[model samples]
Target: MPSFINNIVTLALASLVLVSNVAGDKLIFRNRSDQVRWIDFTPNTDGTNGIGDVRVEPRQDVEFSMDGYGPEWDRGRGWRGNFRAHRDGAPREYDHIVWGEVCFHCDSQHPEFNTFDVSVVRDPNTQEGIHWMYPRGDPGAGLSGCDHFPCSTCYVNSGDNWQTKTTTSNDIYVEIRNS
Candidate 1:
């Protein structure tokens, strides 16, 4: 009877520690529903409105890269995978979540011609949201940006059918948190 009681207490304590540890490291991704469409580059170019560019400032001690997964260019257009960070010259996998937002762009002669999906990646290790800024409406304009972590590069595929214009350039910003 005494041995059984002791075992139960030990199990309960162990479970509590495990639960707390897991909860502490968990991260949540917040998707801003307000989709801002850019119409003109000159006036709308700012962080206040539109899908901004990716910018990583100073760079992070560790660098990570983004890869897209799933059907080439079907419904899962923004499904990103393998955001690997470097540690001691080796790649380490960080737990992350991807959320979506809308992007509006322009073409040669047409105004407000293209619309696509944008995916934002968040690292569970850091509790900061990535910040991006771009002049509203101009998808082809140069993007100015910064981030908490150093972002080396990002790859985007314009699905399977269209390969003419798939990837774009932008500044990436990473937000880092101690806790």
Candidate 2:
């Protein structure tokens, strides 16, 4: 009886550990920035469909310093990244939960929208290449309009163009979590 009880307890503990680890891998994004920033996310591929790589484009703008610092000196800047799918394979459709925003800032000083646009696509025949877009605005909003096909395009008016001109090292955490 004693041995049987011990086995059950051990099994319970092991199950708990496994559950925690799986939960931990559920995708997390952290904001390591010192100032509040704005961000946007767009899906680049149907990694959710077990397709190719999952790519995300992150566009950010750190509000100009409240104090008389010129916009050129503002520490806030832009970023573009591609996050590969988790080891469990592509995320499920319902698991698609994208969330991001100004992690920290000196207050809502800048009113202009600091957003990120993204596009995801995969080639059925050729897995050798991937296509993407930046500053893809809301489709229904008709802000930037939607591209009929996937391409390597960037939105100049959407604030993603800042990366082409300069680099801002500001820490902005953007993440997609599966619930």
Model 1 TM-score on a 0 to 1 scale: 0.22
Q: Write the per-residue lDDT of candidate 2 for residues 37-64, one digit (tens) a residue.
A: 2222233223211213333322222222
| Candidate 2 global TM-score | 0.22
Clashes of each: 22, 12
lDDT of 1: 0.27
- Backbone clashes (count) for model 2: 12
For model 1, state the Cα shift of residue 69 in Å: 17
C-alpha displacement of 113 in model 1, angstroms? Answer: 46
Candidate with maximal TM-score: 2
Q: After superposition, how far is residue 167 of candidate 1 from its true place, in Å?
A: 34
Task: Give stretches of model 2 more than 4 Å off.
Answer: 26-179
